[model samples]
Target chain A: MAADISIGKAPHPLAVLPFYGTGAGFFAALAVLLFMTAGELTGHHFNPHVLAIVHTAALGWGTMVIFGAAYQLLPVICERDLYSVALAVVSYVLLTIGTILLVWSFWVFEVGALMITGGSLVVVAALLYTVNTCATAALHQNSSVQRAFIVSSALWLLITVIIGLLLAINLRVTFIPRNHLDMLKLHAHAGLVGWFLQLITGVSTKLVPMFLLGKSKREWLLYAALVLQNVGLVLFLADGYFNPITAKMLIYAGIVALGTAAWLVYLADAYRNRLRRKVELLMKHTAVSFACLAVGFVLLPMAYYFTDTRWVSLYGTFLFLGWITAIILGKTFKTLPFIVWSSHYRHLTGKVKVPLPKQLYSERLTVYQFYLYLAAFVLLVAGMIADYMPLIRVALVLWMMLAAVYAANVAKIIFHKPMITDGNRTQ
Target chain B: MEIELNSPFAAELVKAQTALMQVIDPELYVNIVDLGLVYGVDFTNEAKVKVTMTLSTPGCPMGDAITGGVKNALETVFPGREIEVNIVWEPRWNYHMITDEGKAQMGLE
Candidate 1:
């Protein structure tokens, strides 16, 4: 038993956390894209609509997925089972319901709804997630890569929730000053780069290698990357909230330096340990996304220095649409197939022959969507930089179409299979 | 495959579930038996025992502890029976696998 169930063989509970969390996040993000695109076309500066899209993506999609990953990972690295599966189920339900309420409040633009119920549910979900994860991790005597991911993720989630509630209340009552949009830049950064990006990096450091059937050796590099990213996020957030000039410059500088280091280390690690020597199309597209991230990061600081807000928006376009969304798109295709395969077909492994996880979806359709998104991303950035609202609107519509294609592709993998496999199996 | 009746230690196999539960799993704070993990037991009159069990999931993290706990408990209980344990993933454990008592304990009722 011990021989067959070694370090890599035994299942990690935290692994599933990332799967469910990322899955929800991807869908939420696509939904936001859909709504935001419509708003752009209709010429409505609907702030509530924007808030809904952002939260749906950040809180609903990003935070939830990170929680799932952390739950699965903590046990493996810490050498422990979760304190309770019941807690996990509870956490998932709260988060799912909370996201729905919050998004609904935003779509309706009801201050009372957003403030009263939306705020409470989001808070409850974040607290539940944090408590469950922290308790589970506390049971382990020693820390692991998974532990690091879970801990940092929990902390950022707390901050993200608080900021979200504050913003929601301010929207409903205007108790806070009207410079709320400016204040939101800080909150948004804290949630996106600090909470979501940090968690993804920590988990992906381990997951990426596991996917490639290789072990991670450079633990120190990962630690350094994590530290740099967090420190940069802290500095960036402080400056955005209090000191605009320094915050703008320092945030850009800090992110570029940190993001570059992390990216380089990521590339080196992938190159060193990567098995299945032939890089798949998903990885190829992912590489392109990283390249876009590097370009955006470097260009962002330059734009800030030149006092070109247009360039700043352009940089955002590159990062949000080009890098982040693109990476999610590519990785989702890889992850969704495996998850659907496991949930639907893992039981039938020895009993009957089945198609591989990669075969669950159409690769050709995904590839086509990837290209369309890339093209749309490029045009949108160009339009934003040139202040061409019409062009931006058109590009956003194209992006919506691409998102639909990606969502459809993912859905086909999950819902295409029946729950019971071969009811005729005799024990 | 078949338990032989000749050795004084053969009866120890029937008590394997009781024996395993005596050992505690520190992480979950529940015995393997109470967790409804032990699936079957086979004993041979030659003083050998075989224990089969299942885990909560394919990639259970505390599998080592549970298996080790079972071995330790059995060794302490029978002292003379040579024990062999097998962990199987077939007919995978789910909520339905839990006994009514286990279900009550788990708050699944």
Candidate 2:
């Protein structure tokens, strides 16, 4: 049957641009914060500046862009219209204000009304996001497993943020009966595994196949992964909160590992059947991201055993700076250019020759950025483990450079103007 | 994929389809015709040209681009003839729809 030509219009560019713009801005800010706090980093994992950087990267850089891309993508993935652009804008405003306030509070090591207010705003934003995404998903056929992943993760994010707010409150009043550090670890895991990992897995399941023009009939694997990962995470959080310190945590980690394996295997099989045989630069970045996931998978259990604060710091670095940042860096070019290109060039398609999405950004800069990032990530991980301050400093400089290059490329996409065309059939 | 030589529209349809070949799927880097997105080329009410098509995937991120390309492609061939694209979901697109030439370009066997 003929579908309506109106087509499910994706989110307006205005609703999304702020997130990507602010996200890039946050990354640049994070790079500067890294250099400024390079000295304080060698100490305990709970240092103020490190906390600030983590929040900035997690909320501002990572979640902000994800929220933006999600608006543009969920419509396509779920094959339905976004429930409300206005709701999305409201969430972005709250998220923006909340993130700035939270990062500032962390920077100054404040645990009073300021931090609590920031945490409360963040909680509301997360709750609003949950409503927006779930309502959007509910508007579509419930059959798409990706919707389940996304909806579940939104719940986890709400939970994660609520726990964070409670933690902020706990910091002032010492009300939480459990150890503060233990609860903190639970909060991080709920966000990381429950929110980030599951959300990434769910989105990628749809995207990888679409981009590759490949089909993998491995729905069972994702189903298994969804069940195992979520179940494992819930158990881990419950045990961590009640029991506090227990060897049984390793068992829960194993369950999560198995779930991660299902996702990895699903992706590998999809790649095997890919019609697009050549893996391009962006896919290579994706490969690097999965590798970071692997490194994280191995380190997850190690974090449980290692009492060394250095291991904890390294864990945070690899998870945030490596796994999250690399994927976003690569996918930003993949998704954002197309979003911008559609905005600029959709009407011009048959009328004239228009640039493909890939041509909108500098390939040379991206290649340099990718290689520089790899080198910096490796050196940073190595430097931290080896207790070498010089290497760490070098890594930080390289990271700042990478951040600058990344911002330049993002700016290039965001501000890409329409090229004049002679209205020739150049396709 | 046969042209009816006896029909008055055969030559014009061939030319129109040939022009449509330039409308490539940006992500797959293959022309829509060879990619098997075009289902038919026919004359509609008042000699208006109609191109029936489907995307490689339903609701593809590139659906609008390729469809816009189709309009421009045909407009150049049949100047001033209004072109309408009717997108259908029937027998939803599968990998086998891709022609051998399309497969070769994508490095598929």
Candidate 3:
């Protein structure tokens, strides 16, 4: 600590903004793709258009925003600085290029060198990310389970991309003995369960309580969640490798489900004890996210039982767009404004007046975006179930508007000029 | 912040504490004075006003802003004096440190 006030460990805004800006751009593009490919949703999800859409959402929208947020979040969780901003930037570039190439290849049904190269670059990027995250965790020897899950998630990301790369290569060579479909299932679950699930659980454990001014005395529940989720995933991958989607897959899924239940229980405890009794819209979005998760959970077995591909598609929609996107929409406002506020107004503080983080963005736009996302998601799911093209197109139209609203708000924050402050503005 | 009756700087300290009411913690939305983050205000150094205080969390992302608010608030009130904010962690801040006004603002009552 400095005798004179130095500062906390916030990374430079530029290091974080590139990913956020690109991710928002990708999401806007994704909305356009959704509108264009509205017909593809009810068919088998392995089609070219579906593959393109999934990659666009997964890599472009989900992973990119996360990479940017992780720079701010990992430091807070680890109580240390990010190991390398340059590595973070490198990974973002690699991910951007790889996603564009890979998604284009999928769209055109080209499964040759370009796709393989794209997948390879993505794998290398994931590896570098894992190295950076692990190095940061190593800086402090804290044994918090949050750290464990965070680091483990990076490892899972590496595994996911490696599997993805191998799958890409196998399209031509067929080197792996296992069935390609089976390997795809393994890769999907690894990324979904291993990477996103664990990462959200870990990060939310810390953030939820802090934001709510809540406390969870149940460390044991977190430990249980950690053990069950990881063990179940390991067994699942092994089963998918050897037996290739056997009946026992249900048992493994059930075990993982139990692990997820543990984390939910912990979050419930925190919510019950929260000092901030009046919940904000952001927290409400979080609740809706879990509700979306429940819908995905219910769809899981139906996706298994019915050979109809729509169930699986619906499951993906609920999990990715419903659960993940909902939370991101809320959390973006939560963290980004604070980050921008700190960067722009830190020096001006204690000398002149300044605005609060919340004042930097439009709350009205966020409310509209939130409602629009929910309506569009529900209508899309309903449209797919009934095979109604008109309804589906309407939903897609709303989604496109929602994406624009979201992007506009993000830009509003990024470009927020320091308006006049009172001689004594504080909060 | 409490003013001791015996202290010679009690009147100046009172004014200083009153001015700090304008500085609120963004997260908590309560004034630091009411939140009990301000430990003491020392006017002994004729040239500078010394503030001893603590944050609700050590790694507060808004640490700079809150401390800077204190500096600005004082500079506005006492333009000639240099403001020195010395953050301490000796007595960690907890819910108990909060005054009734703070608790009311936090909806903890």
| Index of the highest-TM-score prediction | 2
- lDDT tens digits by residue: candidate 3, A161-225: 99999999999788999888889989998998898889889989999988888888998899999
Summing lDDT over every window of 10 consecutive residues in candidate 2 chain A, give the lowest-scoring window: A418-427
Top candidate on DockQ is 2
TM-score (C-alpha, index-matched) for candidate 3: 0.93
**In candidate 3, which residue ranges exceed 4 Å CA deviation?**
A1-7, A420-427, B42-50, B71-85, B107-109
**Candidate 2 lDDT for residue B81:** 84
**True-structure lDDT of candidate 3:** 0.85
Give lDDT tens digits, candidate 2, residues A1-427: 8875334454677768778988999999998898898877756767778889989989999999999988888777767767788888988999999999999999998998999999999999898889989887887654677888999989999999999999999989998999988898899889999989988999899888877767789889999999999989999998888896677887887898899899989999999898777777887888888888888878866776877777778778888988899899888887888778777777777666677878889999999998999999999888989989999999999999999999999899899877744564433
lDDT of 2 at B59: 54
* Candidate 2 stretches greater than 4 Å from native: A4-8, A421-427, B1-8, B79-82, B104-109
**All models, DockQ values?**
0.04, 0.51, 0.42
lDDT of each: 0.61, 0.84, 0.85
Residue A377 accuracy (lDDT) in model 1: 76
Q: Write the per-residue lDDT of candidate 1 for residues A75-170, one digit (tens) a residue.
A: 555445555666666666766777777877886777776455766777777787677777867876656654676677678878877887887788
TM-score chain B for all models. 0.74, 0.91, 0.96
Ranked by lDDT from best down, the candidates are: 3, 2, 1
Return the lDDT, model 3, position A28: 94
